[model samples]
Target: MNIHKISAATIARTACLLLALTNQLLSACGKPVLPIESQTVEQLVTAGITTVAALVSWWNNNSFTAAAIQADAEYARLKQKGE
Candidate 1:
């Protein structure tokens, strides 16, 4: 028997990474990311941000306060909108 423990933050980041990667696959392969090339810049930016965010999240995991603050903020944001 085995037990698997997954934190909410890990799950959230994984989902975000997966979605970003899928969107990047659609955007970076010269497909129509947006209505125009300039507009597609946002998609590229989002891909970059997700990569950075994931790395930052990993780095912050070593710090309880930082990770907790981020998690708390996300929780409050979601709860405010009834998510």
Candidate 2:
């Protein structure tokens, strides 16, 4: 019966429907257009090595970040204890 309530509900429902349609379209478009052939054993091994190196680099960076976080937390705890 209230015009404001009706307009707000309509807008909310339209937004939700649009978001769902957009997600569906995006997912559908994300598939590769062409089929890929299987790689040779040598190619697979090289790819595996590359992946491992990348993972190791990521782990090193993450370890540095984690260590920094721990150091910061310890510093904060000590500051609080002193105060």
Candidate 3:
């Protein structure tokens, strides 16, 4: 058997990348209309904000929240309002 350990930063970055790709893929004809560079930048920003918010919440409540989940919900809300 083989085993590997990944750091939290790596996991967070990977999760953000996957989220961005999935969002793009599901948006238009199974294709990404936006450039890959922009998608990456946007995802990184979202990841950074979510990380900060999660850390603040953890510091206050001693619990961690799922960043991707909240991001998706917020995205949907924004989209519905045509923002």
Instruction: Point out where model 1 deviates above 4 Å.
Output: 29-83
TM-score of model 3 relative to the true fold? Answer: 0.32
Q: For model 2, what is the error of residue 18's alpha carbon versus the real structure, in angstroms, after optimal superposition? A: 0.3
Quick one: RMSD of model 2? 11.8
How would you encode candidate 1's per-residue C-alpha lDDT over 1-83 as one tens digit per residue?
89899999999999999877777787778663433476577888999999999999887645359778898889889999999
Model 3 alpha-carbon miss at residue 56, Å? 24
TM-scores of all predicted structures: 0.36, 0.30, 0.32
Model 3 misplaced stretches (Cα beyond 4 Å): 30-83
lDDT per model vs. reference:
0.80, 0.74, 0.80
User: How many steric clashes between backbone atoms does each model show?
Assistant: 0, 0, 0
Candidate 2 lDDT (Cα, 0 to 1): 0.74
List the candidate numbers ranked by lDDT, top first: 3, 1, 2
TM-score of 2: 0.30
Better of 2 and 3 by lDDT: 3
Using TM-score as the measure, name the better of candidate 1 and candidate 2.
1
Q: Tell me, what's the RMSD of every candidate?
A: 14.5, 11.8, 19.0
Span of ten consecutive residues with least summed lDDT in model 1: 30-39
